[model samples]
Target: MDIWISKIGYYFLNVGIVLVYGLLLGAFIAKTMARVQGRIGIPIYQPFIDILKTFTKRQAISHGIMFNLGPAFRLAGGLGTLAFIPVIYGNEMFSNFSAAGDLLLVMYFIFFGQLGMALGSGESGHPYAAMGIGRGLAQMTAYEVPFTLAVVAIFIQYDTSSITEIVAAQQGSIWNWTLFTNPLAVIAAMIAFLGMAAYPPFDVAMAPNEIPIGPPTEFHSHFLSMMQMNRAIFAGAKLILFMNLFFGGATGLIELVFKTWAIYMVAILVGAAFPRFRTEQAVRFFLGVPMLIGIASVLYIQYWAQ
Candidate 1:
């Protein structure tokens, strides 16, 4: 019982650290984008303030039980994803509950939150919300093709589905990292990541300027707060996942932050350079070159790289 209690405490601490890092990283991205476009942008503390304000506000409208549960479900998705992934690798306090096959479980948790959000949004009876859900799910499905292929390649290369084992395999030298050892898979995964990050061309599902405002259009107050919090946590968790998979997992907190930040910059720089694509265009793009690259990766790993 005491062991379980200690694990829970460590998990919470891990969550707290990731949450803060994600929020600040998001704010920095916002500010950087604003500067690129010649605007002053928001304060770095804006996200923190927004969370506080939203939580303190009363929910004036209720959209039924599922509607109420949507944000919670999304938050659960983020938390669940983080819970199963080792944070600092080897560090007991930050390792969370990571175990064999956690890579697959993490992927499931990622999908779980989106589906929960979809159910909640569907219950809201908002036409735009429905449209948003459809687009988001469709796009998610399209990208999963290449992403799954990339994972398959990694599994074959390392002979394991456990993320910790994958990270372990990559240790010893920089070239040992998947980024070098399995460049094809990394390329495919990184391309898919552009869609996964939901930036620019792939962001049609919930683009702020779009007519379809997407899932959380009807959410407010504490509901919105939870969603916002989850967004940060989820984003940060993804960055870490990529860092572990391809960048040589960090041995220290500073290294973790730097590597994850670098990985995120790949998406950010791409997003900044491109214009938004229509849903069809985005879907086709992912299914085209990225998909081909992913397949090639699996073939490469199975035939030659091994």
Candidate 2:
């Protein structure tokens, strides 16, 4: 029982960090995205406030049962990925939870969340909502080719995809960052993450003009509120997971947060700088340049970098 409590306690700490980190990073995107449009934005806590208000309100509006339950499952899925991902400091405490043979573990969990989000959105029964869901899934398919190649690059280097081992392999000094060692990976992963986060240029899934807020269109009031909160958390957690893959976790919480924030800021800047891509055009571009980068990273890692 004591062992069980300790395990639960360890997992809880990981959850708290990822959730709060996810929320704060999401707000940063909100502020930056809004600023790009020259509008004032809500406070960072606005997402949390929205969540609280949502929980207190009557849950009468969502069209389907899964639509109502989607946020809960999405939140659970997002937190679940934390168990599969290891932050540097928490590695010893959690131990082996991130064990795996290749990039498949990371890739699968990310896909799992995307699947749940799409399924939940589909249950909402709005036409535009369906459109947005379609866009996101289609976008998922478009970028996944390059995304998989990038993972292959890392697998070649570490000869493994166990998240904890990956972090362990990269310890000590910034140059050890996979970004530095495998320059092509840095570029490929950047493009992949942009699509993953649905930032501008690749923001086709929620393209406001194209589909009236994309897959999330039908959501409003409280149900919308949970979606908003989970979206924030999900994005941040994804960022940290990538950071772990390349930078291999940090020695301290402050260092980890700062690094993750820096990464988030880069995506935000890119989002602000580029105009949104047309849905089909977005798919083509990801499959184009980013796909090449992922391939190049693989060749460099497998043929020469070792």
Best by TM-score: 1
Query: Which pairs clash in model 1?
Result: none
Models 1 onward score TM values of 0.97, 0.89
Return the TM-score for candidate 1, rounded to 2 decimals.
0.97
Error of 1 at 29 (Å): 1.1
Off by over 4 Å in 1: none
Give all candidates' CA lDDT scores.
0.91, 0.75
Give per-residue CA lDDT, model 1, range 115-223, as digits (tens). Answer: 9999999999998899989899989999989989999999899998888888888889998999999998999889888988989878988887885578888988899
> How does residue 136 of candidate 2 score in lDDT?
84
lDDT of 2 by residue, 1-306 (tens): 876677668777777666677877777778877887898998988767777786677755767887767666666666666666766545466442566753466577677766776777888888988888778888888888787888888888888878767777787777887878888987888788888877788887887777888777766667666676567667766777788887667767788888988888777788878998877887898889899889889998888876
Q: Locate the minimum summed-lDDT window of 10 residues in model 1.
A: 207-216
Global lDDT for candidate 2?
A: 0.75
Candidate 2 clashing pairs, residues 3+ apart or interchain: 132-215
